[model samples]
Structures are given as C-alpha cells and as structure tokens.
Target: MKSHWREYIHCDPKILIGKPVVKGTRLSVEFLLGLFAEGWTEDQVLENYPTLTLEGLRAVFAFASECISQEVWYAASMVNQTQ
Candidate 1:
C-alpha cells in the first residue's frame, strides 16, 4: 500500500514554527531532504537518527513531492503573465 504522508508528517506552531516535521519528532522535512541532498544514504540517516524510520523518510519525500507539484502548477499558471 502507498504510504500516506499525513500518517508520518505533522506541522504545529509549537514545533519548529510550524515547519512540516516527522510526527512525534522535531526533524523537519527540509532538514531530512538536506541530508539526502548532501549525499547521506538511507542507512546513514537511519543509523545516525534512530528515532526516524524508513516510513517517516518516505513521508518526507511524499510531502516534498506534494509541495513541488503545487508549486509547479502555480508556476505553470503564471507562465504567460508578466513577472
């Protein structure tokens, strides 16, 4: 079954100023994405941050994909308009 991002991700004003984060943890989606961008593998992340699970990692990607898709749609809509 496809993992739902909402199952593992959360955002609260009390947490990182409402940045989307892994539920029950303070790890932000942006921070996790940055780890991968910096060449950290799944094993590296899991080993270093035992609190994070494989599913939580997947949720982070899912959340980011959703955000990018929305951004892409908005950008496409403005493609023909003057900046």
Candidate 2:
C-alpha cells in the first residue's frame, strides 16, 4: 500500500468540475466520503462500486487528510480586519 492519493486519484477539468476522483472512474472523493458518513462500510462500498479498490479508498482518505492538514484557519478578528 503506497498510501499516496495521487497514485489512485486524479483531478481533471473535464471530470466532475475538477473534483478529485479515483482513477478511471467518475466517483468523486466527496461522494465516497459521504457514503462512509452515511454508514456505508468499506465492504459495502466495494460491493457497490466494483471499480473502486481498497487502495483507492485509502487514497481517498489520504487525500482528505492532506487537504485538511494543509488548510489554514483564519481568526474571525483577522478576517474582519482584512475586510
């Protein structure tokens, strides 16, 4: 398991408005995360989406983690000052 989202996921302006998706599939990372949020198990996800692999699922999480980790949260006061 490389644990690298880039290895399994990609974004294209031609696909889903440039949202990240598993390679070779139209499924978006947000959609998959929503499925898990709605109580869909890994097995169930795999069963429903045969094109998705365990590695791809892991990549989704990895991509999300990277995105969250890189996010910058601005303070309300700072935002107000900038306005």
Candidate 3:
C-alpha cells in the first residue's frame, strides 16, 4: 500500500516557498516538526491545529523519516572535491 505521507503531504511552489505542507492546508512540515521539537504532544498539536488530523501528524513524521533515510551525507572537506 502507498504510504500515508504520500497522500497527506505535498509541495507546491505557490505554498510557503515550496515547503512540504499538509494537503488542503497551509501548515508546513517544518512547522509541524518544530512543534514536536518544542515538546508539544500529539494531543496538544491536534487541539491547536484543528484542521490537522492524527493521520496527518503521522504523515509528517513519516515524511521526515523518509527524507532522512534517503539523505546522502559528505564531510565538509569533500565540498571542494569534484565528482
């Protein structure tokens, strides 16, 4: 089955400088992640952003996980090297 994140999150150039956002809302994924970093609970987030659903929250996490998993890292010294 398709991941819930794929269904719930999207990026549009016209929205928040193309940041990934919850579908049908202007809430950016970065903002959502920040809330969690600030110690906001799932219930608190739901209460504050009434437009967001539990599944949407899960999607945000999933999207972040997917992004991190696919990221490639290089040492700072490698910046000057050519392929």
TM-scores of all candidate predictions against the true structure: 0.82, 0.82, 0.82
lDDT of 2 by residue, 3-83 (tens): 567999999999999999999899999999999999999999999999999999999999999888789989899999999
What is candidate 1's lDDT per residue for 51-79, written digit by digit as tens?
99999988899989888867735565587
Judge candidate 2 at residue 37 and give its lDDT.
99
User: What would the per-residue lDDT of candidate 3 be over residues 1-83, giving only the tens digit for each residue?
Assistant: 12668899999999999999999889999999999999999999999999998888899999999898799978877976855
Identify the runs in model 1 with alpha carbons over 4 angstroms from their true place: 1-3, 73-83
Give candidate 1's error at residue 24 in angstroms: 1.2
Q: Over the full model, what C-alpha lDDT does candidate 1 score relative to the true structure?
A: 0.89
State residue 13's C-alpha deviation in candidate 2, in Å: 0.8
By summed lDDT, which 10 consecutive residues of candidate 3 come out lowest? Answer: 74-83
- The pairs that clash in candidate 3 are none
